[model samples]
Target: MTETPSTMQMVSFAAWRDGALHSGRQADRRYVTLAELLVRLGSFGLGLSWKARLFDRQPHPAFAQMVKASAGSGIPTLELLATDAPYRQAVDGDFEGYAGSELALTLREFDSSCWEVRTADAWVLSEIQRHYPDARPMTSDEWDTTT
Candidate 1:
């Protein structure tokens, strides 16, 4: 059975960057749980299996992008399956561990761009609010009317 997603509200923040409409700044995006905020925690750790660790330590840019996509898709957690990955089955040895290999595979095969954008926006807003308590989310009108 598929697990139902928990009730999670996502806030967003937007700012001018590099004089561009879509700056695509990395640090400008972030996300966290409301409960986590209450306790002053930003992220949760997901222990990976040995196989998954192989890709995780030095993940390619695409790999990181895929992770963002998954997170955006409401994947609360990424799990490493017990089965061996077909990609590296030939070099298989005593590689027994629950790594996030399944997640990697899924991301590589699927596309979740829309979800990624949505989640990333929320993440950025959350981070900004967390770091700058006084800095409020602004509207186009507010920005224009300010100065």
Candidate 2:
């Protein structure tokens, strides 16, 4: 297995349709690696059966693939969204899960060249920056902003 990259940009878009947690309608960024990213991602499945499957002290299989896929790209990353905040916080100080297990599973199950591939096989950060070049690094104070 490849050593997880030390750090990668984490881009979090908000989930407006998801309700309350989605109220903080700002995308954000932070640096993280496979370990933390898994916890952060797994948190999304919190209270669900998949929660255990989402996080592992070691990277989960799905997450490992994501790490490997991103590692070969220009910017190693595990892109997620703001709807993930509560899950991340619920993990008891473990910044493990991010809110994209569905995306991860889709990528893992489908052909990379398939039209359905959501990420279009591009570096996630590239995709984010391509669409929202104005996104800046997030500050703790701005974390709760609903804009």
Best by lDDT: 2
- lDDT for predicted candidate 1 compared with the true structure: 0.27
Candidate 2 stretches with Cα past 4 Å from truth are: 17-122, 132-147
TM-scores of the candidates in the order shown: 0.21, 0.21
Q: Against the unseen true structure, what C-alpha lDDT does each candidate score?
A: 0.27, 0.28
**lDDT tens readout by residue for model 2, 1-147:** 121222333334321112233455754433232233333324333321112122234543444443343332212122432223322222111122223332221111111111111122235445444544443444323322311
Off by over 4 Å in 1: 1-6, 15-43, 46-61, 64-128, 132-147
lDDT of 1 at 99: 25
TM-score, model 2 to reference: 0.21
Error of 1 at 15 (Å): 6.9
Q: How do the residues 1-147 of candidate 1 rate in per-residue lDDT, one tens digit apiece?
A: 121223223222222122224556534443222222212212322342222111244445443443344342323323322122322211101111222433211111111111100112245445546654543444434323322
lDDT of 2: 0.28
> Positional deviation of 31 in candidate 1, in angstroms?
14
